[model samples]
Target: MLSFTPYENPTYFGILAIALLPIVIGLLCKKRFHWYETIISIFFLVLTFGGPKLTQGYALIAYLIYEVVLVWLYTSYRKHKNQTSIFVGAVILAIIPLVIVKLTPAIQNGQQSLIGFLGISYLTFKAVQTIMESRDGVLKAFNPWFFLQFLVFFPTISSGPIDRYRRFKKDYDHVPDTDKYLQLLQKGVHNIFMGFVYKYMLAYLFGTLLLPKLQQQALSAHGLSWSLVGVMYVYSMYLFFDFAGYSLFAVGTSYFMGIETPINFNAPFKSHNIKEFWNRWHMTLSFWFRDYIYMRLVFFFMKHKVFKSPKTTANITYIINMTIMGFWHGVTWYYVTYGILHGIALVVNDWWLRYKKKHQKQIPHNKFTEIFAVFVTFNFVCFTFLLFSGFLNTMLLAK
Candidate 1:
């Protein structure tokens, strides 16, 4: 049994193209062939989790059933009773598996959890969001089968741009008109080709070829040097292209399926500040953190008068929210530090903007200033990515 990770290479896209053909034809004719979609989804799911990864396949199935039932019960409870503790407990239960998966490596000398599966974090995000929205009365219905379909939506299944249940259901239940689908097809093809450039060509050059060599040189130096600086910048670009490329493929595939899944990257490097960078980079995830964690924390703080001032409240929330995000990446000092740095950067960015607004006459805003801001933001982000890369851990900690 041959297995492939989603969008791992050109050959994978070739297989995907063939698989997607019938769905394309059906949509072009203003019809949705639901059975055909199901067949291909299962096929790709198997390809992703079968063969050497069969354990993960079983884990995914078990996790899916668990989440489905959890959400169903929560929704049922929410329809009659809305209690904060119950809602919190439900969210915690939904995340327990993901938390274990994250902690297993740290506690077990870097061994992966047996129950961990690809995209578990992403799936948990969707599940928890659904429960929250349902509690708030936004999501009124919970169809187990539809919920399963949304969770297993193969395009963004492995790593997501994280589609919402309501939005996904709208697209899943309707077929686009001919003209609209043609537009989707055009955008889809463009995205896939651009993804080809970003991932296959540029990422391969930077990540597979140059990153190793730079790592070798940087490691040999065993301290701060130009080689390490080279690694920082190169790794930043490689990370951007590689991830943005994968996001493009995910969104593109979603488009092909007539679902307008949100785009994850939007010229993030061109951002003028750390806040703007967050707005552009991995936008879905950032927005998720902003909405579900940061905003909620701020609201809770204000509601309870936890802080004397709004500024202090926001600053503290920024740190905590980002640190949690960092921990979500992994239970490591480096990841936590990365989050803390970004949190500080965001606070500083906010302060600078406020200062500029008050001193608008004294502070000159022009093309030169704009360019300088972009340059500074880009380099600052690259530096943070260096910390996030864990190469420093290898260099300083390894005996």
Candidate 2:
């Protein structure tokens, strides 16, 4: 399995060095590195690290072919207006395999998962979103190379901020200024270090030591009350660090290339409510669901309601949409549970919001109260992650 291990692999370091050479050369030649140039270098770096995973390799090849076909489809649509819906249909058809592979578990187990590829989910979403946007007239121009660059952009590919097509277009159109390049280089260096600290130090400590110890003790005691709670805390923190670290690297790299991809995380643990957490954490993905998935589902459900229901009906639809979004994160019963749990939390949060709006004098607004809300929200998120973690499988199966 490909790990989120930082810098322990010499091959990765070498690849990073190789990617940097272009930037150095670009600077020396007085040619500011374009976003596409940085993208190419990053692709080389990731390909070098990819080494030899059969399914992953095949998936990448498949993705490359898919990108070409998508570009052709886009071009054909632009050339002949009559074929626009055909292009949309083709893009939807393209996502079938990804959906199947993700929803089917047999392919991700035993020796199969070893070759099953890392970040297929992330890549699939990026491709689908891009195609959907292109069909919606969000992307006015299409460059095959640029499309491929966005499709397989290395740093964010594994775990993404889920860059939007319009934003990407705008960023790519602008070239990097020299001073800005220096700033990005500084930020990239800092992010690389922080990624190491998060993955190697914090996550490693918990994953290798604290978690294992707790799991063993929990099993030995034949009870999981306390251990499960501790495991939840540790795993949640690990997830935040692991994913946030990757996002930082991605944004920093894009910055170096003069493409300012939107930020993914914003100290999500500090969020005072489930809605706030969703807003701050995985900001891009949340917006993706909000724009592409949630609001549409809400409107559709509202339009087709059994009665002319109140705002509550619309809110229920939002919860259902978010539940589905959570389910999209993985293909397991635990993921389903996680989704449902989050949906409930969001519903309750909405209720609270409405209550506070109606009775402004009721809710506490003290620092301690704010801190408590943040604490509760953070733990709620943590517990869901614990349930989703593979450790819960042993207990469930034993029953």
Candidate 3:
């Protein structure tokens, strides 16, 4: 019995390749061996959570059972009755495990919760959204088995491009045409190879090789210095590559199974503003927040006259939504600050956009401005990543 993190090393990918071969072949031949797919998925789950990580395995199992049944019950109830209180209760219950997991570390001086396991947050996201959609009458026909598959879709299970229930079901229920399947295969191979460069090569170069040195240098500086700047830039690169690389692997693996999982990142560093950065980076998660949280909050605010102006409503929701996202990352002060700053950036960016649009005749819209915008956004993001990294906390402690 052995345990491994998803996409952690060469050996895991090797096993993955062997396992995916059957799926690739089946898709090529216009066949889907779902039974086989389930078996391999379970096998990979074991490799990830079994052996020394068996406690996590148990937690995952119990968590899945609770969520699946909870969704089932909600779907059952939603079919006939739609009570807002019930829906809210269900959503809260779905997130309770994740909340406890997050709070345990902060409350208990960094002791991990017994019920916590890798990807709990992601799983909770899936479950809560399912409930939300169910309440909205969007996800009418809820298949418990398929829902379970989507939640445990081992490829994007741990960290996600956060596929929706309806979207996933559409892909799962259909077989792509020959040409499309071939294209998917080609892209899948390309994505996996690209992931190797991102996660293994460049991330290693930045995070493993460069980040530690920069971190040590920055820490010893006892104050802001060039070393801190180096740490900021190197860490920003490392964070992007590490996550973008994982996203590539998850999406590429999904492609092999003919599932067409949504991508998580674009050229995020090229974004000209914080809003655009979010749209380009972690596309799925941000979109989820937009659809499920921000949009809903805005609608509620507007509906109930919570704010006099629609713009004000949006600005307030942006802060609330992103702050929750930050807390979702962790309970630490740095994480919360990271979210709050992004929220403020979004508000400011929106204001600037509105002002620029009104003064379009006076405002110079040119190539240079675009480039300058990119520079500003990238550097601002890097500085925020410095906060997100918790190195500033270390600096404060050193002081």
Candidate 4:
């Protein structure tokens, strides 16, 4: 049976509270590793790894090994001033673990329980992106400790906004006034409550009440799979509230620590287009893709003989970017479908925009169009979420 056991588990909640204590204390002490803003992130990583039961030890061990190697490589690159080569190397290195995990299904399905809860993907990307930015001279270099802190920040570690180094650095560099800290605490507490409400109240409520019926209907082939569609909508909304709410808590918690981590969502459901939806949804991860993947793809394609002009071959770039976005979610066919669906949507949106621009006098500029666009865009996104949440197969095979 489908279950919401994780959310209801008191032991897990207790562990989370305990894990956050050290981070709170560290913040109170104005903890700065190596007197560098970048180094302070290590403390939070430790706390994050300590949250889960079975995987805590393994996470800590992996984190330690990662910290040692990352520090060594970063320091050597900095000392030799080989910034360009080192940056390229960091981006490549970040992919190693992700590649290994994805290619080796055995690792994911292995008996080792620790491997299952390994939320390494989120941390690894954050680390790699920070290092890449540092190498590009876009962000300042900080010692390993600061990097670790950002990587392991407890609230967002399990799921994340995938914050970049430059923004993180800005937060850590500023000393907060007492009033600011108090305000942060107020917001943090409020956000935590709202997170619970969004998570447990709406998302969880709909999920528990409706999702199992879809699963059953899908199994029994008893109906038209309308239940599955309902579940998809619920799942989509559930995911946002649960994830975005958590990110809000992370932002608020970091704020209290005198670190102004960026917000992750901005009314993403209201987006009229796929591109706009991405901008509002998981804002940090989208930016990460823009900076690390999309930009690189654009440059690479532009350099190739087949794609000389981005203006003429914009569709190619759009397809490549969205496909990469799909792959980033996981090594699954469903994820690929989700990506392709969005890619096509983006292309259509772009064409429509151009058409409207070319015929501005004839295009409708009414609120109705805007409202209709929002409704269509939302349902489109919800349809894709079926693939995202792995309900597509469940719906298809249901009796």
User: lDDT: which candidate is best?
Assistant: 3
Instruction: TM-score for candidate 4, please give it.
Output: 0.83
lDDT of 4 at 150: 63
Q: By TM-score, who's the top model here?
A: 3
What ranking of all candidate models by TM-score puts the best one first?
A: 3, 1, 2, 4
* Winner by TM-score between candidate 3 and candidate 2: 3
Question: Candidate 1 versus the native: TM-score?
Answer: 0.98
Writing each residue's lDDT as its tens digit, candidate 4 over 1-399 gives: 111122245454565456455545555565533243233333444443444442654745675466447755775576559655666776677666665655465445633433333456777778777666656656545666556656665546666767766677666665555566667777877766776787777766667776677666665665556666777788887788877766776666565556667778999999987889988999988787778777767776777756766654667766777787787776677888898888788788888888999999988889999999899999999989877987766555552
What clash count does candidate 1 reach?
0
Count the clashes in each prediction: 0, 0, 0, 16
Model 4, CA-based lDDT:
0.67
Full-model lDDT, candidate 1:
0.93
Query: Comparing candidate 1 with candidate 2, which one achieves the higher TM-score?
Result: 1
Q: Write the per-residue lDDT of candidate 1 for residues 104-152, one digit (tens) a residue.
A: 9999999999999999999999999999899889998889888988999
Relative to the true structure, candidate 3 reaches a TM of 0.99
Ranking by lDDT: 3, 1, 2, 4
lDDT of 3 at 392: 91
